[model samples]
Target: MKLILKACIILIILSNTAIAQRLYNTSEKLWKPQKDEAFLQEIATTIPTNEPVVSVAETNETCFALMSGNIYALKSGKLNKDNSAPAGVTELKNKNGDIWALTDNGIFRFQNDRWKKIDDKKYVDLCMHAGKLHAATSEEIYRLEGDRFVTTKPENGYYSSNMTMLMEDGTQLHDDPVRLGPISKIESYSGTLYVLRPGKLVLFDGLIVNEDFIDWGLLPSKNTRDMLSFGRRLFISTDRGMGVLQGAALKTIKGEEGLPVENTTCLERGFDQDIWIGTERGAVRMLKDEWHYFGADMWLPDNKVNDIAVGNNVVYIATEGGLGVINFEPFTLQKKADFFERHLEEWGHKRLGFIHTVYQKDGEWVREISDNDGGHTAPYLAAMCYKYAVTGDPEARKEAVESFNAMLFLEKVSPIDGFFARSIWSTTGDKDEMGRHGSGGLPAKWYKTADGKWYWKGDTSSDEVTAHFYSVSLFHDLVAKGKEKEMAKQHLEKIAAYIIDCGYTLHDMDGKPTRWGRWDPEYLLRPYGYVDRGVNGLEALTFMQTAYNLTNNKKFDDSYNQLIKWGYAANTIRQKNVFPPENLAPWDDNLAFESYYTLLRYEENPALRSTYLRSLERTWEVKRMEHISWFNFAYGAITGNDCDLEQSIKHLREWHLEPIEYNFRNSHRDDLFVEPGYTSYEGGLKAISPREKNITRGSRNAVALDGGQNGRRIMEPTGFIRDYWMARYHGFLEAPETNDPELTSVKRRTEQQFGAEPYKGLEKPVFY
Candidate 1:
């Protein structure tokens, strides 16, 4: 027994030393060894055009877009009219560094920066094969010989069909087949040129034309729009799905193989190992086993993708409205965090020490005075705490202190002691609508402060309180020092004591408990309260346990023990409700995790810890598929387990640079696997990428398959900033060994704070 005690002492010393060195603000001890790696960051720059683009091609670092029967060249990232080109151009192609345009009257070659008509015969399609330019008229296949397209007659007659036309809006207009003896499209791969007829494909090998290479009867569909040479195989787009032809063996990639859309319109080879497919609805990138969707106003000018052109690390997507250019740049996670940090200031998301989302009004970005500003700012404060703990930056420390003070001010401004307001607003603020009632239809409980400077909103729910305790706990442990630490302890004591005084309820000025703030047995023990009993029990226990841990107060300890004996500990086992559709809410998981972090970290009783751990495991298992970085990091920090780090990082990396709430509808996708609404009303088997979904602030359901509105409102990027810094502090994610010197937040800070000269390369882009 003595030896065992000595060993325990040694373990305690080692643990304390590790904690002191890492300076984590949590009670739990866990850390991942820092790994050095860089992730590519995607940034989109939309180039708007008046006319719809029909086709696009890139060669020799230059891109050309054919729009409205005219050709335009993209020079220095902007499109310019190629005046020297001939009119009536229908399609453009690049063959051996030569730009060729197929016009309505003839074929033209760009020579000495001037388009010269090479052949006077109209051709339906053209391609480059075996180091020669090939064109197919209605009856004959021709090859280029000394700038002239000469006939490459075959033993068999050429297959032909009426050419498909595009509407002015760049959408394909499929007409009833007339079989007018015109080849619609032509493609070449592996020394063989494939010709598309009305319902069949014919192969031409410079001498012979036959239909033996591809058995059209075995393909997904007979009506093919486009074909692409992908590695060793030819991918043909059809209405049913994508057909793959490899050495006469035909296969299909449909919904069963994770094709998001069924009606494939066109196909293009991607910059990487991926392949780009265009549907009538949107563009799809098949990167190995994953499918990354690009649609909606956030990603494209229009969902109708006409053509796609790849350049270096960028992709130019021609749509009905304009060109959407997606540029891929090297970025570390640190650089992304820096980008969001700068975003908050440049977009005016901060007001009075609180971070806010923005909505457009009269062409200006206006800060929204949301009902849950206090609750919304909690994560920002928590982020600062983690940032200070990890970097020891004074700016982060100052920000944490100011935000904590603002949170405590919510309680101070209220008429009743220990009763915090949902939000505080100035009487003479902007004319935006202020909510006069809570979600439960309670009367608006607005009261003037003693100084008459603010009107504090009342009838606060447990959400605000939960945020307060969670962030304050972190602030005290991770950021607060000396006098500020003492202040945090007292602030927590007052709130916890107030709850006890009111019999586990937060009351308004009317001396009645707020509708959702009740945690006492009188409320939670009833059948109507069954849904909230688990989460509320968890919250109350956490408050008492955290208060006692910080202050060593016997009163808090006694109350905590009494609550545990009252079966509240057992009640927490079901804290994460997964049944009864109406009871499913995304924010409930947020509150439960906030309580779980502090309660499990500070709770010392081994038996109770086991129970809480069980609850945490159950809840996390339900949430693991979301790939939410906060939930994953919190679980990893507490349990020292592999908590989906790679998926979490992927989630973080997929965030769009712009946080606009654009409409995203994925319910019609063929590859979507809808699960039972166990966790959310619209839960799915997999969480969609943040880039393809509505902009979220961590509380929204990640599994919600479809949601959004007009792109007028923008969300604060704090959800991303907080999760990233928390991961850094907990060592779940490490700082990259190399970072883009211009994109770092430190560069912005040095220029703004230290009066440093701005380097032209480091100048930041204005987001708004």
Candidate 2:
């Protein structure tokens, strides 16, 4: 009933809103506060007490955050007590040889070791932009001219008190009705004034220069979080995570690359171009593309760094405990990488595998390289190889590819009739006992014997057919371009045959002949064990599409259509039919698989194309609003149309720290936890258990297991699904022209290098 109602609501909204208008619906919804009184109360109290002291300017030295509201100038790490300023200090500037500080009460100047306070009634924040000292307040903005502060608003439209200055010049200039209701705070950056209002971020590019403008909502935290300008963009720290504003969009960087602490106190620009983020848990410094944590180990006094300021080579941090100073320096990538490698090796290198059914040692079947219990090892190795490829390191690529080749020899039989065995070690590579090898059949399990013979077990279901299809498709692509052409061809043929059989039968695991396909066990449905058909259908379509590209067989095209029909059925069911609340498939999840294949195979379908654009917008909203950790980053990457590469890069960078952990019960001792570095298991932490608790964790035991990790123990279904999705969308795999301008440019350059036409737009070249 819940799923049905939710679907209805979604469909109704979709039907009423125009596409352009629909594009922003998700984002708008995220920015609105929920009605729950408790939640609202929590939000109301979530604001940080400290604001970032971005840059401190003085005539001869830099000013630093001293205590609560107090600031002091420092030269060579020594505080100039005579020039120290009190709380409520708004702006600091250097003019001629004099240091000027603006406050709400008055303006103060320091010279000859003495302080002179100038009685002034108006001042807020101060900055030196476009070669002049400017002060902006909640009411108005002004520029300093020699001995007097002059208003920047135009003389004709300027109002003395209530009127706000949208932009200011050396002289008063008014252009439009200033909307001050939404702006709570403002900062000046590179000739632009950034306004931070609840739920909105408005950028005024020409305070005294160009009149260009752009604005976007901070989707992650609605309007409750604070904003700080660091590097080339604005960073927003909300209850969920941190977000970076790019152009008119806000991209979240959470899970691993983000701070572990939730309540962010302040953000300041460090002297080495690093952004120092202060959170309740610790102080994080990001510089030269690396993030370093200063917490318990550094004697930070308190986890929360209330405010930060940099002077000369010293960094002053204000926290709940007190003020502290430390020498700051830039981080070198080489040194950082070396440090990470040491941590990775210390974590351990155990492998993970799946067993369908186990039996006592027998001579009837033999274990094959493909039948090896470590199912995830190959994909993990492949991911590592891809990483090395990105780094352009020849040695890493060689080692990764070699590992992949070793894993391939484990395949012994075909799981589906038309495809290779689902499990390489199974007697007959069948997931269940229901289907044959060549036609569209159900999933099955395969096992190998020590006597060089293979045996089969379990029920052969359609879900297994689809899983094998996807796995084989990825395997074939990975090896096809290299020297493993024959091996790739073998797997491709098996997958093609399996897909053909499925299209012909129209039957899946439930013993029902329907258009919809079954969900893979690894990619489980919500509320635990319940299975859905969308995943199966989507994977089949993907396989068919890949097959068409590989063989150019019209039969593959027909298969693709059959899969699409199932997709349409699922889509219609999701939109109009009755279902359970937890069962309703998220449009973003469906699009992760559906849109990729549609873009690749069904480019001519106008409805699909139009819906695809809308889907991307929806996906973006989901990512922006949802509290995603490093594990869920794949969802954002796969829905590439919704985000740019910059967001993907941010997520990838975060994963380097918050490594995913996998736990398995050992025979000799307690449960052992293994951590795979950033490249492996991007899907947070997960736990797996043997079907029987009595079974030992040795090589010979029959094990039962499930997987998922959500800051707590989860069953196998969620774990498997997260892993599969993460693998599917890991990194920027399919470089589309629209999504990746850099890759497109690189492709064009490669084409030029080879004297071929550039890979025009999103189309891939046909290899004869």
Best model number under lDDT? 1
Compared with the true structure, what per-residue lDDT tens digits does model 1 show for residues 562-584? 89888999989878877777888
What are the TM-scores, per candidate, against the unseen true structure? 0.88, 0.38
In model 2, what is the error at residue 603, expressed in angstroms?
Answer: 6.7
Question: Candidate 2 on 71-189: residue-level lDDT in tens?
Answer: 56554544443344545665454444566666768877766766677647645455555777666655556677876778666545432222254336524444564443244445665
Q: Give the TM-score of candidate 1.
A: 0.88
Q: lDDT per prediction?
A: 0.77, 0.41
lDDT score, candidate 2, position 167: 39
Candidate 1, which segments miss by more than 4 Å at Cα?
1-36, 48-50, 74-80, 155-182, 214-217, 428-433, 441-443, 674-685, 743-768
Which prediction has the highest TM-score against the true structure? Answer: 1
Q: How many angstroms is residue 281 displaced in model 2 relative to the true structure, after the best TM-score fit?
A: 5.4
Cα lDDT, model 1, residue 85: 81
Q: How many residue pairs in model 1 have overlapping backbones?
A: 1
